[model samples]
Target: MAGRGLHHVTLISSDAERSCRFYACFLGMRLVKRTVSHEDPGTFHLCFGDEAGRPGTLFTLFPWQRVPRGRRGACEAWQTSFRIPSGSLDWWSRRLSEADVPHRLDQTAFGENCLTFEDPDGAMLALVEANPFTQPAVWNSSEVPAAHALQGLHDLVLKVREADPLSELFREVLGFTEIGRNGKLVRLATHDGAGGTITLDETGRLARGQLGAGSIHHVAIRARDAADQDALVQALHDRYGIVTTEPKDRIYYRSVNFRSTCGLLLEIATDGPGVDVDESFEALGMGLKLPSSLEERRGELELLLPSLPIPTCNRHVFEEIT
Candidate 1:
């Protein structure tokens, strides 16, 4: 069966609030969820996306303040790109400049206009004009106007020492169609090129990537629901003899994870029980909303974490809660 599309891409951050300012305020995404990492309570897990925090639009970050800076190399996701409205590249370039975020305007081998930049923590990101046929939800709270706001994730780039095995996994297990190649970079897309694509780069000679601050943790592919996830999990174990985790409730969605051939983490996530399930649509990311297990200790955990604003870019979407 073919994968639906990209669900979300989760990455690391050195400071949650700095990342928030870049993604929510500068980039015009909405902060849809505020929670602590399931495995760690000292750090924060922030989810940013379109207004509703839809599956394909979601991007998450785990702020680990003490982690060392990561170096981009083979066996790592080098960049995460977003789709922007056609002809909005100029607006974004100026906006990023206003925020003092360094960026450069460039084009792909296929001649797609792209604005490439790095986050505060040095994670690579690009904004590419989307296919005009597809429309993205408008985020009204941004410092940017709705017409120029970011759409959602456009694609990801994975650099690996060897491409054949991982390429096989992308086509055989993940159901991505090999579209075309540019030298060492091979592009693959799901859902007949309608959804986000992943470019696997066969970096000839490079060190193995080390995950730390500013590195992508995993790339999630969309699965319809519980049964669909189950089928994919079983296929991994039975057909490919690859081990996959059982479905786990992530509050916003259900997920199953496995390590790829090159040790890159991959996840399959469902699209339901969305961002509004725990918080109201209008009040998303307003305050810390913890799971039932952590609810009793909410006060303690809240004190342990740093405070963040509601992503208004200093223009005030919601009154600052201090």
Candidate 2:
């Protein structure tokens, strides 16, 4: 039950380096760490969050180039969001337009005004104004000024063909409760102090989303530590009769993952031994890191991955700060 808050969202990409740059430069986020994915060491795994690489502020990138592109359907989470300041929506519009990024012409939906855009890999990204709703970021990045930087991931929409077993698991197993519903969408949030919204749709038909180019691979939640993550894993198994692996070290954190009854893969990751434990933020994200078992193969892993640069953003917020 240490599922404190939304720790991070992991997504699939064709090129980790490209995603690393786009998120850093455009969003004012810093690439805090780079490592070959422990599960699939052949691919690059990158994490971008605030300067300290805090838990709730993370956006992770995985390059699984060989996989086919996934289709966006009712069952698939098509878009993940970020909140900019209420009045800064105009500035974001101009910025995306100038970059030649295709954004859904500004629109109002779900009580917020947002300019939706796609990343180089095609993940549906949105820059929305935190209007009518106003508990702003306690801390924000320089790239997106305090006034315009992304607040954080608000909610995720899941397009499900059916919501029976999925809804029950979310309640009985995952500790989420029904907050609200609109038409065919059911919104569920956890009581664990994080703001994650899962929308189950019955009529929002969508094809199987391809997992390549730009798509979310899995949604990961934070566990206080190995013990907490274990408890969650056990609770899941006991509640639903689903078995999961013992905790596995992910270098930065320990994790236990399982695909839910709804077919959505969810992971519970420990919050300790962060990406900064071994390196300073000044020295962050510069090299490929390997686990102790794979330390001997570091050279091989490095050779397979792309040569990467330290991710930094050059947004002109300093001009405003002056």
Candidate 3:
């Protein structure tokens, strides 16, 4: 029942257009899928990732135009971090400045350099120079250069009232090993590196988090296949008395979700029949895609969902960098 790594982190956004600008244009992630939320057909579900929308690289969003801003506190996935090349922080700083995206250079307690920033909806994000550099999948089309493009998800930070119980579950059921600790921060990692790291920050005094725009919906861990996913679900039930829902088909992947001891939502997601299942590589994210159930009402749903703007590189900034 060893987990692969992270499948994706889902977040709520107030506006789809603003999210696209921040994530796609400025951050340089490609919008690999554009679809409607299965739960709420009126809302847009936008998925951003590497060129292929790989499991560890995905950041999916549900945009609710009128949702209120959320408050960040305990029992929340506080920040999402992406992996960047070791020497690319300076280039990223300059690019962030040029794009008017406010960010600051900071270091973790473990001394890894990171650039922290926020999206239009105020979702916290960071780029860390942790993992070894790898060529970006969207190199040719991204606003960022190949050398500096974001590689994939680095890790996630979870702010919890207590870390011990959750940490134990991760070790016993999720196959994570405690790698390091620094005061309130306890770091854990799976065998895989891409989106395998997690830092639990114990903040017992913080208030409970509220769900709304700008808050993380859930963090999904990778399940290699149906059998792997079933094994995990069984282990959780047998060990911790945790009950998970039956696997729900998400078009690209299947998922089973449950709440952690700290009240943070977590999901186990299978990795097959990926984003390329329905669209060709070249035409990914170019059109609105609907499931078979919704195909008949595509016109009505399209009218309900707001039109999204296509993301493109700013020629002025691109020229300056070139």
The C-alpha RMSD in Å for every predicted model, in order, reads 3.2, 5.0, 3.6
The model with the greater lDDT, 2 or 3, is 3
| Leading candidate by TM-score | 3
Each candidate: what lDDT? 0.81, 0.69, 0.85
TM-score of each: 0.93, 0.85, 0.94
lDDT of 3 by residue, 1-322 (tens): 5768788999998877767777787788889999988879898889999889998889999988868989998999989999888899999999889777789999977789999998777889999997573444643345677688878888899999899999999999998899999999999988545688889999988998888888999999998988999999999999988999888988999989999877789999989889999999988888998989999999899888987768655433222111
Q: Write the per-residue lDDT of candidate 2 for residues 1-322, one digit (tens) a residue.
A: 4235467888887655556668877776667788778878888888876666766667888877545666665455667776556688788878777767777756533456777877776688776665423343323545566666666666666667787677787776566787776677677776422245556666544555556667788877777887777777778888888887667878788888887776677777778889888787677776677778989998888778766666444433111111
State residue 276's C-alpha deviation in candidate 1, in Å: 1.4
The C-alpha local distance difference test score for the whole of candidate 2 amounts to 0.69
The regions of model 1 sitting more than 4 angstroms off are 133-135, 192-195, 312-322
Collision count for each candidate, in order:
0, 11, 0
What is the C-alpha local distance difference test score of candidate 1?
0.81
Cα lDDT, model 3, residue 152: 83
Give Cα distance to truth, residue 89, candidate 1, Å.
1.0
Model 2 scores worst on lDDT over the 10 consecutive residues at: 313-322
Looking at model 1, residue 128 earns an lDDT score of 90
